[model samples]
Target: MFSLLSSTFGISRPLILKPQTWRIFSSTHVNHALPMDPERRKKLDERNERRRFRIAHDPEYQAKQDEDKKQRRLRYASDPQYREKLLEFGHIWNTRKSQDPEYVEACNASIRARQRSFDKLRVRLQAENPRYRLRKSLHQWCLKHDWVRETLPWKTHQPVLFASKVHKECKGCTRVKVREGVKLWWRKIGDRDESWLCHACHMPMDNHTAAMPYGYEDVTTMEGIINRKQELERTAKG
Candidate 1:
């Protein structure tokens, strides 16, 4: 009967008649069946503390940790969702830091330094390149001659003519010029050929000091132009 009872209760020991022995065996079996032991838990805690201490005290370990962190950040940044989260976090961090006057002044100082560096570089480049000086002189001449300013259309109060739209930079002349608000000035190369020139450079060749605007007194028609040219020739001869 005792053997039958032990088998039924799943007791590992041989039949013992004492109740105290049965209790001791059952308690010991329960302790052994537990998932974690006290000694194992203590050993795990110690290992984790040592790792933390090494990460703090050892330069090599700290560098490894930083590299690992950088790699993780790069990986996360490649993900669009994580990138948005990182941007939001950075904006919030910067916004909080911007409240400090020292931080604001430091940022302004750095910006001023960068601006000064850029200015020095530009001056150095301009001094090194003769073409830059020539271009600057040409630009100044254009401005001085009023070649790059707005003009009213002949006999009309419509929208002002923008010089940049009507004329281009004339490389042949010391100054740019406009003609009848037109961009091209063509000269006869032969009986059947013509060559295009900018109005500014063409003015001297055509014996004109200034460009004639469109709709100027009877110069609008072919006959008017011929008569005007004849009158100018007669005046020049006289």
Candidate 2:
């Protein structure tokens, strides 16, 4: 084996194994290691890039699009099973797509394009959505909400979603259980009850700008944190 390698490289096996020797001659010897035509590679890369650009820009191919549409229309119009299959496929596709950034950005852009002028009445009408009422920062919402105070007390360590017949599991991220020690959010001596969040989600929540209303300067530091806690306690008492 050693003699064959030495004969092939015209160098000692030790020299061939040496990293420095490989680095020194890598530019010349790399083709032997991974032989491929540079021009061919360049052409392939260009072709792939063009394909990606076309896919991103064009929703459907111009040549086959009409025929494809015709087939789909005929299938839907003629076959109930085809229509049902399409509906099921679309539901699943949209379910996945809702989480996609590109889809979300496109939806946002389309909504903004058709956005009506925000009058007071329009604002009030939009605000009628129950979601807006619960849009407060986690801390503020947890602190003020009676639902958390009385029902879901801060001292409760294992904060879990109610397991009814339909839902037999926690609604948290279904990722692998990396650690047994999930971040059990509690109302600390100076805090209100926050929901039990996984370590990954909890970290981002704590560090995020949206989490802190007045800014981290008020509650980030030890001294500031203490002051804020005392203020919260006072408010609770008052």
Q: Let me know the TM-score candidate 1 reaches against the reference structure.
A: 0.31
Candidate 2 runs further than 4 Å off: 1-35, 56-175, 178-218, 230-238
TM-score of each: 0.31, 0.26
Angstrom error at residue 115, model 1: 0.6
lDDT of 1 by residue, 69-134 (tens): 677567765887765554454444444544656645554665587789999999999877644443
What is every candidate's alpha-carbon RMSD to the true fold? 29.5, 21.9
Task: Show the colliding residue pairs in model 1.
Answer: none
For model 2, give the 10-residue run with minimal summed lDDT.
Answer: 26-35
Backbone-clash count (model 2): 0
Candidate 2 per-residue lDDT, tens place, 1-238, comes to 2222222332211121322222221111211111134465455456546655765677675335556657767786799887666555444444454566764565455445546544655788756743332233343433444443334223213223222212122234554552333322322233264434432343333334333323232344335544665677687799
